[model samples]
Target: MNDRLLALKLFSRAGRVGNFSSAGRELGLSQPSASRLIAALEADVGAALFSRTTRAVTLTDAGATYLMRVEAILAALDEADHEARGTGELRGVVRVGTPISFALREIIPRLPAFMKQHPALKIELRVTDRYPDLVTEGIDVSIQFGALPDSSATARKLIRQPRILTASPDYLRERGTPAMPSDLAHHVVIISPAHPSPTFSFRKDGRVVSVRVDGQLAITINEGAIASAVVGLGIAASSESSARAELEAGELVRVLPDWDVGSMEVTAVFVSGKTIKPAARAFTDFLATELRN
Candidate 1:
């Protein structure tokens, strides 16, 4: 490989892994070699790319901006290479950010099929509820829900997942079924900390009714809330996709089948202006198709 291309590739890996040593390992180079390459690249670029510390290495602001452009250039080059070879094979790392609950309940289960389809692809799935910093983290793509915050990244709506109020049969039997939205005030509710308000809005009879629910437990994660609901802890408001298996298996039952708690919009987010990698594009397209169906 040419010195410039090699340096850029090393920089990309180092930015993604946040460690020169690990990046070097991935590129089959020693730590010292990786350091030297990155230093040479920085000298050429006339900027420090990383902030070094004892515990971790972090991308400098300039480095983050540069990485975005570098990624786009590399992606274009890869596409050219594929065209020249007359093959559309995808090969590279696709780092994806997604919510933990969604990954466990939806994506992870379907990942094996995707992996089989792209044998040359390396997937690094990072599960978290927090909004990911795409450039700094080197995340190729992210799956986000609900209202998207103002960002420079591009977002495309993938699916509108219906939200449902659910509770275990045992819990309903013990606590008594709630007949109206107002009755929820008397029942135990499992709330997501992400939604701090005690009130839940449901549409019924062409009107939206807001109900204030009380619960002894508040979960920070959707999986925790769903698990609590399944074990008869309290009623949980969750996306239909996440609770599909549990509901189908009779582990959890719908709380009010007639009312709607609004739908969660699932979006695929990617860095703006950066060329989307083939692996990322393929996986995202697969997700969109599968989820919409």
Candidate 2:
């Protein structure tokens, strides 16, 4: 790659990951070299692109804006290269953001087939439980679950995952199954305090009831909470898909099956300002089809 182009690539990656040394490793450069290259790029542009502190390296206001434009330029270059290749294949790297539990249960298992289909494409799968900033991370697309807040990003629904409440047979047998939604107040529940769902709503035959749950055990991760519930911890909130295999193996049983916990939607999210690269678009389409089936 051209020197300037390589620096720009490093800048973009570092800006999203919030680290230079890690980004340098990805691009096969040392920390000192990464710093020197970025410094040169800053001098060329006549502005400091990142604000460095002992604890963190963050983009300055101007740097953030410039990143948008530089990324656009790079994306366009990628598109031009693909068109010129004349092989009728999707070529280029696509960075994807996803929650870990979803990726493990749904996405990763299906990746082999997708990769075989687009052998020229490269994927960088970044996982986190929290919602990622699409623009900052340069994520081509993300798979998000639950309700989407009003935002600048555009989203397309892939599938509506029906959420469920589950408990191990041992736990249910010990505590006795709750007959009513309100009865949950008397039972020990598993919850993730980090997430904003302190309240859970259940609906049955046009009747809706919301319950505030408190638990002795708290697991911040969704997968951990589900796993905790498996060992007879307490009732847990889970998506049907995530709990599928466990449910089939008779380790978990649906609680209050007559009532519904509503749907947690699975969606493909894209930042509004950028063009969806052909490879990214194809990946999202493939994910949607697989999820629907």
Candidate 3:
């Protein structure tokens, strides 16, 4: 039997007031229950822990000796609990930088649940349509879509989403569908200004094709581009995960099913040479699991 925990609490409380009733009240246990726990502790140690009378109680010599060690042990346990809670409970500010579209559609919905898991934590989310230098921006974590190129910061792929070239059914019916990647030149393309230097590489039936396509309809934002494409304005390429609902709802159709339009490897990038904050690390892990599912 482990007498340490029961004895420790019993001894600490008893030592504090030198009375069983007061100790029992402080520890939220009945006097009889507390006394029995201390009595059992005395049996385990083979020593009389307390001198009791109808009127009052006092510590025995053994109890006095045990009291010092119990106090130190309890103090250490409390300090350890505080440190563990500081890490696990996530009670600090975590600055997160992310793309606007993703922040709006994906991460925000799950924010409440994550906050619930760490009630004491405060999250400051910065949503930008442009990439920011994580170190300069003082961001703990950055969620970015597309390939991270020539970045000095450390990053890990959180999710891999395949890009698919899609067009509205009305657009396809009126302008005619592309028979091949080369045929895209004959169709009107709606390009997202969000990606200024967009180029695509596709593989179809073991044959690779690269295209540097330009479009007539250029928009400054992704939501507007997606909206325009759905209204049959032109064709555009986007991550399949983002376009899944639209495609499933018959708002858009895949332009080329056999060819892969290239995959966007969304990554969690952090500042170089810095330990990721506990909150940021926890959030990143949660995102990775969510995207995988």
Query: Highest TM-score, which number?
Result: 1
Q: How do the residues 159-270 of candidate 3 rate in per-residue lDDT, one tens digit apiece?
A: 8877777889999999998888878877767677344554567797789997767678887667677788899988876677667778899999999788877677889998
Q: Write the per-residue lDDT of candidate 1 for residues 1-293, one digit (tens) a residue.
A: 88889899889878877999888887788999999999999999999999999998989999999988887789889778756766656677789999988899889989998988778878999899888887657788899988877466688889998888899999999999998889999998887833546888889889989988896788878888888999999998878888888999999999888998888898999888778776778889999988877
Off by over 4 Å in 3: 1-82, 193-199
Candidate 1 vs candidate 3: the lDDT winner is 1
Once fitted onto the true fold, the runs of candidate 2 whose alpha carbons sit more than 4 angstroms away are: 14-23, 39-66, 86-88, 135-138, 193-196
List RMSD in Å for every model shown: 3.0, 3.0, 17.6
* Candidate numbers sorted by lDDT from highest down: 1, 2, 3
lDDT of 2 by residue, 1-293 (tens): 88899999899888888889988887899999999999999999999899999877999998999989998898888788778977857876888988878888999999999999879889999898788887656688988887665466788889988888889999999999989988888887887522346678889889889988777777777888778889999888878888888899999999999898887888889878677777788889999899878
Clashes of 3: 0
lDDT of each: 0.86, 0.85, 0.76
> What's the TM for model 2?
0.85
TM-score of each: 0.86, 0.85, 0.67
By TM-score, the better pick of 1 and 2 is 1
lDDT value for candidate 2? 0.85
**Most lDDT-accurate candidate:** 1
The TM-score ranking, best first, is 1, 2, 3
